[model samples]
Target: MTSLSTVLKESWGLVEDRQDRVAQHFYARLFLSDPQLRDLFPVQMDVQRGRLLGAIVSAVQNFDSPEDIDGYLRSLGRDHRKFHVTPEHYSQVKVALIDAIRAHAGERWNAVYEQAWNDVYDHIAAQMIAGAAEDTEPPYRHAEVIHHERRGADIAVFTCRPLQPLKFRAGQYVSLECHYQPRLWRTYSIANAPREDGTLEFHVRAAGGGWVSSALVRRLKAGDMLRIAAPMGSMTLDPQSRRDIVFVTGGTGLAPVKALLDELTRYNRTRFIHLFRGERQDDDFYDRRHLDEIAESCPWLTIVRAVSDEQGYPGERGAIPDVVSRHGPWRDHDFYVAGSGAMVNATLRRLTEMRIPSTRIKYDAFTDA
Candidate 1:
């Protein structure tokens, strides 16, 4: 018998090029079958359309790796609690997904592929349901903005206090929804560690078509309220490993990195930490003052500033990966990278080129809200 992964991958390849069409068909069928489900999504379907296909692609890509994919599915399942997704919804999605695949696969669709997809969807649904059930925290929290500061023309730094405690590791991220962008949720890293006052800090940049990010950066104020979902992601510190660390950050990617650093300052006594923050222009370096303050007090920490697309910069120049490369011999050190997809991909490529082991590297890449 052909393995489930093999069948799923082959079937996925058949419809991958027509992802948008598949997603559209799937959602259409989903909404038609159960019109009430339409209320769960945003008014604008553009970004939401991409997210559905993205999740499917991710699942298909890791089909062969049960352990790897199971963790992801569980986290996804837990996160979907914010949408109030039930097991019945999973069944509806599975039906729509299979229909979508069949519609797009045309003459290539087969019973083997259908059975494989059904089996895999069952597994995925089971895992997600289990994950959601295992989680004890609430699906979302109501948070009141306590502070908001515009750091640049496009960037804003804000802090919010959740009505209930939000337990999260320093390097994890949480999805947030605001009234201004109803039903649209955007993930942002918590810029601070778990605070005594139950405050969470986030740094956001308004991208061209990012509705939620625009609202966050431009319209959100001290009294505004945000609905934040449970924390997710695994790019966190390893308490067991005391390996010297290197952190690479670009743009507003500094949020999680700063959170990790803040946590490290409390308990890290030995690891020599190097933080390299890069920006396109000198003026875009927003968190230098706090970083400099930390570096001054912690002799174990070193800060390197880099500016690309700017001429005659006093500090290191060029892309973040290039700057990091110049300071290398980092093969023995654990690395954490956070940035835009392009930035993270570039850094990952550089790290791979330099023969850094995958186990030693952790990263989080964010898309526009």
Candidate 2:
């Protein structure tokens, strides 16, 4: 008897190489079946396709672990409410997904594989529905951008005051939709910890051609209102235990780390904290002044600046993995890593090599959002 995990893993390997085709075909089939569903998604399907495939693959990879499966599915389900995903859409998605796989997998996809995939999809959909049912608040809230700051060349810091109190943990991220781009939502880590007022902050890095990120950083101005979805992500620091904290942040990935640090400061817990912020050059350290101020205020905080790829940089220059290892034996510390997929994966690999317990590490990833 084959386990569900083995079935899903094996089938994933068959389709991993041609994921691009799988995503494209899946959307084509989905849109063809119901033209109305197409409006829910962004006009530009290229990026969304990859993200969809990646999300599905990630789900399958973690399905074997009961906790991973439950947590991820619940988050996905709850977050989908903001996208206005309905019960019927999940059914449509499963049909499109299975059809895409069947067409692409060809001879390799057997009845057993089909059954296993179907069962998994059924579980995913069920959990998603349960999650959606549990949420009662409005799908999203309105936030006015009261403050905007351009740091470095392309980093935009926006301070938004929500119409109502948007309760969220320090390290959680929020999906924001700019007026300029309707229905085109992007995920940005809330850069500040919970404040007394009804306000939240985000640090956005404008990539060369990223539509939302580019527009927010370059074109967005104060007084513009943006639609905000419920807060998502599980990056909160453990409040009960006063564990030493270690953070590895790449670029604007520092946002969540900053929030976590603020959380620590709020509690005034005398725990040791180390933050290694990596950038390309000294100028890339947009929050240097702020970080320095934080270190001054918090005696237990230590900041390590790592600059890579630039010559004669006036800071400790090396990749994140190298600079982190130089800091030496970081035993018995809760590690928080926020960065691109490559940065997080590489940092995790390096930390594991140092014999740190994998369970103790917490990750906050910044991707297209």
Candidate 3:
């Protein structure tokens, strides 16, 4: 008898190559089975389809890890409450998912494969349903856009005032839904520290074909109403930590890093800090002036700018991971990394090789998808 992990791996391998088709087929089957369920999804299925496949892959890969599926799935389930996901909907999804996988896997599909998938779905559904049951927060928080500022060409920073006193720690992110897009939602890190005024800030980097991001960056304006879900993220400030800190940020991943910096300022005593900012080139330095101001005021903070694929960069040249490798040992420092998936993975590998403890590292991979 094949183990559950091995079965899942082999089955996914058969369908992964045709993921787009499988996602399409799955949604088609789902809506056909229960036409009313269509209302829960966005009108745009392109991004949603990819998200489904990504979620499934992530679940399978981490289901049995030490952190286990519960941690990630519970967080996902809680956030999914904002989407109006219910236990009944999970039934439709599982049926659709299995039908699609069987159709795609063709001859590779067997009774054992079917049983393995059934068990996997059962476990996933149990965890998600259990988590959702305990979540008591409102599905979404009402926010009024107080300010919208664009930096360079692709990114926009928005300041919003939650209608209620929205409580969240620095370095956390929330899923945002614009009134204009109806059910469409995107995740973005909060860009500032918790304020007495109870305001929130988000940095959105418009990615091609991202409905929520393009709308947030280019079309959304001050005075527009936005709905934000409860804050989610673990890359938050460690209140007890007194060790030296290292921050590595790429692109708009700088949002959360900036928030941590803001939080650090309120602390009476903070260890020395090193920040590495990575981008395509100098023009992409969207928050340099602000970062410079922070570095200037906080003598403990040092900023290093690195540019890759650009010629004649003045300070540091090459990818951020390479710059971090060639420059510092970073030993004994609490490291925080926020960046694109590739950037985060590369930096973590390098950080481990530099003898940094895995426990001391915190990272969030910023993605609009």
State TM-scores per candidate. Answer: 0.96, 0.95, 0.95
Pairing residues by index, what is the TM-score of model 1? 0.96
- lDDT string for model 1 (92-111, tens) is 98889899889999998989
Candidate 1: the clashing residue pairs are: none
Sort the candidates on lDDT, descending order: 1, 3, 2
For candidate 2, write residues 1-369 as lDDT tens digits. 767888888887778788889988999999999999988888777646677657766776567766666766776688888788999998898899889988898788888888888888888889889888898877789989999999868898889999988889989998888877777888999988899997888999997768899889998999999998888887888766577888999989999998998888887657899999888888888978988999998999999998888898877998998899998678778899999888999999999899989778889777663
> Which parts of model 1 are misplaced by more than 4 Å?
1-3
Query: Alpha-carbon error at 90 in model 2, in Å?
Result: 0.9
How large an RMSD does model 3 have? 1.6
Model 3, runs deviating above 4 Å: none
Best candidate (score: lDDT): 1
- Per-prediction tally of clashes: 0, 0, 0
